[model samples]
Target: MRRAAYWLFPLIAAAVAIFIVIFMIQINPSAPHMNDGTDGEESDTSPQITEQSGSWLDRFSISEEKGYFYPVNEVSLKLTDGGTATVAAHYRLTVPLKSSYELFCVKEELKKSELPYFMRKEGETMTLFVDSNDQNRLVSLVTKLKTYQIKATVSPYTEEK
Candidate 1:
């Protein structure tokens, strides 16, 4: 009985360790298929905008006079080849009065451009900057126009300078 118990103890511990390892693998299988493969697909990727099918816009009061900021708004990208892509708007703001704001908007058009000073695009993301001068320009420009709509698209990439 003593010898039997001694062997059973190690067997129980080994079984428990095996069970834990199996449970962990079952819970989180580290398989490559789990990834969406965006890294490889990004080279040929184009901008796409999600279609607004159910009219959720009606629920929210989307107005330029409301002095609201629409963060990460979706804008449809119109490609030169007569195709459309759905891209998220990094930031959209309608300034009713002069105000300081910090936001991000994704601009697909800027990505297609070669201008290094204004915009930068990498992979499937883009980043844009609205400095103090840009904010002032926005305030001045919107004041003159009775109604204005400003949509900014930004990339989510760090410039490699």
Candidate 2:
């Protein structure tokens, strides 16, 4: 009986370890090509621009005197408090054309109590405010954006007469 108990203890421990490993793998399934041809070195893929740095809307023809020629779709803005706002319409930015060159866009979402901000269901044009220096806000927003599985695109805009 003593020898049987000794073997049983090791067997139980091994089983527990295997179970834990399996559970971890299940929780975070490895990507298809995570380890197919890598030797602990980074891949040779080109760097991607995940987010635009400067005032993107201002650069385009979306300024106050000039309205946007193209429409934005499938874009969602996430707030600091985990609240999300859907892009409704594009508006003009009141800032100077050369001063930061900011543009505004209307967004529709439930009123958030944290910011005391409300979006109009009709004729609602809200200013999209973003701080170029706020790295923390940018990181937080980028993390939340991963759930949408979207890639940023830079579309060429033509000046309207």
| Best candidate according to lDDT | 1
Each prediction's whole-model lDDT (CA): 0.42, 0.40
Encode model 2's per-residue lDDT on 1-161: one tens digit a residue.
99999899999999999999999999997644424237877665543532253455554533333432456666576557666755433222111111112112111111211212222222443333322333443344434333443222222223379
Residue 45, candidate 1: C-alpha displacement in angstroms: 6.4
Cα lDDT for residue 38, candidate 2:
71
Q: Estimate each model's TM-score.
A: 0.24, 0.23
> Candidate 1's C-alpha lDDT?
0.42
Give residue 102's lDDT in candidate 2 (0 to 100).
18
Number of the top TM-score candidate: 1
